[model samples]
Target: MNSLKHHILSGLFMWVLSMQAQQRPNILWINADDLGLELGCYGNLDLKTPNIDRLAKQGVLYKRAYATAPICSASRSSMITGMYPTSVNSQDHRTINMTPLPDGIEPITTYFRRAGYFCSNGNSHNMSRGGKGDFNFLAENIFDGTDWRQRKEGQPFFAQVQIHEPHRDFVKDKEHPISADKVTLPACYPNHPLLRADWAMYLESVQACDKQVGIILDRLEKDGLAENTIVFFFGDNGRPHLRDKQFLYEGGLQVPLIVRYPDHFKSKVIEKELVSLIDVSATSLELVEIKLPNYLQGNIFLGKKASKREFVYGFRDRAGDAVENMRSICNGRYKLIWNRTPDRPWMQLSSYKKAQYPAFSLYNVLYKKGELAAPFNQFMVATKPEIELFDLKKDPLEFNNLADSKKYQKIKEQLFQEISTQMVAFEKNRIPEGEKTIEKAKASSLKYYVEKIKTHNPLFTADTTDEELLKDWENRLLKK
Candidate 1:
């Protein structure tokens, strides 16, 4: 009688484990490159994004979502680690072979993998992307394949699909390209024909990305995974434009975030609380009843009992060879920026950026002729103040500087202290590397990349005779 009872208890324990495994929902994260909050659902009427709008209608849309870092690889690194980039020493804009993530830190996907989720880091539609990870640290065995089709039978999944659109070198498609005349220009940009054309091309790229999102959603439905999968759509960073992509201003960090899971979340709701991209991993784990580790800094924002965030932080460091260091703190209405290297010009030399946009080239002409207008000319100043304070509620474009205002002293002091405390906790050092070290890092990166490319293409040979080609390659490596 005792043996029979013990056997029955063992069977019941296995049955409970199977039920828990079946209850976990699949997670799908779609991250777009350099896309700002310009979607139709985000109050930008000039752009056409029907698919994303429908997703918003069926999900929760966040109005105040931001990336911890504004650049590509840095932001992605922070996101995957669920911590601030500065904390992990990954805030530099360009990283070569690998970044030294902190000893205890690991990619958030590793935890999901241990929990029996079949993870992937590519499109669900099986699109080819040349297999470029582009992340700061190594990613091995974290992602099983490019799509969910490679997952074991009856296993839950966590997939990420990255859409490269609205970034610099915008796509120009034949299918109803955006009209230059109809595009609405930002107040900080000059209204030139060339600038308008650039804006139109960016909007066109957004449309193409929207269509791609539709394809991914359709694929989920066809695969019968929509009901059990939670979909998150957001931009990896901000828009690729002057004073946007690489800067600490609103355009540089603010991104559109939408989360959809019909079974456990409310539909057609708009959240106005501050949310950071770092919260994504924690939120996903919460959906499956997993407790976030104590080391994670992000809070869960998807569940019914979500709490509001008091402040969101942003960091910038060593963008290309420019050697910039800055930090910012925002409370959704006011923003405070501390420019560590105030003497450095905002428009530092970046071959990667200057080649794509008319900011530097045309700004020189406009400044010489005194044709540049307000807000547009502000960014062209040779030097900036050590500190900048802006009431975002009033100056959405971040035009007027209120750091020196006596009336706002209390507010400014509060934010400054908060940011300083956080920075100390993270052990963030704002000192730029020495000139020799910066040059060494650049040369080492160039050698590694040149050799890696040659390894992939055995027939290719470096042109020793062409000085321009070597220079261009070095510049690209610096911009990598």
Candidate 2:
């Protein structure tokens, strides 16, 4: 009876297709959680994402796409409202779970829904912002596993389908068939069996999401809504893990993005343009020939494209029961990091918490002794230098610190200036800089996410057992 009712409803709604007003094209956005460019199209050597790769062949694949915030909620929020995290007064990831939102940070769907487009989010409404949760426009549930083709013809629609796979549960490092053995891992972490197994599961999730993408595309074609629909597929942020999820590294912020509009766009292109998830607003809005809002901070990456950015910015406000505050600015050539807590370091938010995970403990030992691999030691364990500048051209892994080098003085000066300017702008948009200092980073992290995570710190080691201490730098440093 329920299935009959749905079919009857679908047939009745299909009748609405006869009358075609000057309505906008349908919008379908499929986003993955904690995903990067890990498909065949995005250069994931481990797996074959035939569907995602097919979409790339049919559309334009972005080379340098980025998430506005490395953390999920912040990036997701920015994409919805088309604004920077700081602009929304959401610069600090800690406040996401703490403070109430400022005005006008609501979902743009409210605006689109008001404009007569049927808006729905299938399944995962994994949004981090917008206090209004009561606005349900669907007849019953937007999360009924329906894609854009499921809608009635001639009725303009906007559908968002999200996938939350390959997240946290990959902790055991269990193998998932397809793997990342060829994919390089940072040196701060050691190569281990458990880690490999965990990564394989992560790959399996990507492949699984890819399979779902195939289903949606097939439906779009079967329903004959192919040409009129604009499809955008991407990740909410970089992968969810230690350095990637909570920290502002490329592995965290950089993601694969693709846009497809059959009737429009002439080029099957590869744009190395630096773009953030916030700019996704521009692409969506422009496809419908609508003017972007003035307040949106991101530049339009397509449709009368402008000069691409030199260096985009990323932030790490909080994650995994801890707040690891940081601000980073990256150009294709260089990157500069502003660690909010520059003094006290090495608070394990991921590996240490799960001490059984050797990646964390193993690196802990090497990092403390300043003996980790090139970029791992440079990026993961190099105690916060307050301001870190690296020539990305020379150090793609971001393993070098050129802040003190005179050889790259000009590059350093330019980056420093650019970062400073960005900081001021961010400050203006941020909560007032009160008397907060990094005096007790560890304590502050524990206090902030005290409720979210269980206590999972490493076993304290004695100074005399430095050799067998696993990776206890704090013991050696403070003689603990």
Candidate 3:
């Protein structure tokens, strides 16, 4: 009889554990690469993103969401680890030698797997493969399977769907082609016909991405998992454009964030509070009733008990062939950017930009002809200012610089002090990767860009002047 009682009690415990797992909400993260705040939901009237607009109406939309880093690898590293990339020595884009995460630091998937959640990382359309992690650190065993369908019966899941769209080599949207005339180009970029066409193509890529979002959401509802699942849709960084992707300007760091969980979060809410992309990991863990680790720098930014951030910080280091260090701090109203390497030009030698960005080429041509003016010409200078301050409320495009103005000196000094303090704190936990390692990486990147330029555009010879290059590019790029 005692033996029978023991068996019954063991069965009861197992049943209770399974029930607890079933009660937990499944977490779905739809991370879009090189996307920004150009969706229909974000008030861009030119773009047609019906699916994403509907999602925004059904959930909370964040207007002031910012990325911790402007580039992919560094921002992704921060997202997975819930820590600043600088702290883990993952600040550089595509580090030369990948290293294991520091002691006691692990990807968020580690915590989820420990609590009986099935972790998955996959492409938006297919769950089997083709997901982009691009983490600077060595991430092994971070996911159990590529799809949530592979999990056992009644098991909750943490799935990340990587949507690679809108990141250069943009395919024409044959179904819903956007007109160049309807698109509005940023003020900093020259208003040329080729640049307008490029902007329109980017919008088309965004529309295609919206279709992928609909597919993922539809599958969730069809499987009857939408109700018990928490959905987060956001970008890995800013949009893929000149003066956008690799820079620390507003266009580079600002991204759209939409969260949907009907049970816990209110619907149709527009959250204007400053939110860091890293907060996604912390908020997801909190919603699933997991205790946040003490070492995590990300704070929960959802639900009623959400923690509000006073300032959102960003860092840029070694993007492509350009080796530079820049930092920014924004308090929702004001922003300040500090360039450690002020001698480097904003238009540094980046082969990827030269090949992929038509507007970049146009800017070069226009600058040589002395057609570029004011704010647009600033980018073509030989060196950048050591410090830049802008009141976002007055100058959203960051065209006006107030760093040296007497009236704004107090505000500038305060922000400078805050950033200095934070940088010092970050240095305390920074990993030392040695100067030799960085030099080796820089050399390799420089060599690749120089070779790429020569091969991709043979007309760009040492003797080819700016005028000759412009005519050649226009003839090649402006063809129907």
Candidate number achieving the greatest TM-score relative to the actual structure: 3
* Model 3 Cα shift for residue 142 (angstroms): 0.6
Best by lDDT: 3
lDDT digits (tens) for residues 169-252 of candidate 3: 676789999888878887767788887878888899999899999999998899999999999999999999998999988889
CA lDDT, every model vs. true structure: 0.78, 0.62, 0.85
Q: How far in Å is the alpha carbon of 243 misplaced in model 2?
A: 2.5
- For candidate 1, the 10 contiguous residues with the lowest summed lDDT are 461-470
Ranking by TM-score: 3, 1, 2
lDDT for 450 in candidate 2 is 35
Provide TM-scores for the models. Answer: 0.87, 0.76, 0.92
> Higher-lDDT candidate among 1 and 3?
3
By the TM-score metric, which is better: model 1 or model 2? 1
Tens digit per residue, CA lDDT, model 2, 214-328: 8778877887877988889888888765556666667778888888888676537565568878878766776665555666677777776554767788866644345556788
Model 3 residue pairs with clashes: none
What TM-score does model 1 achieve against the real structure?
A: 0.87
Better of 1 and 2 by lDDT: 1
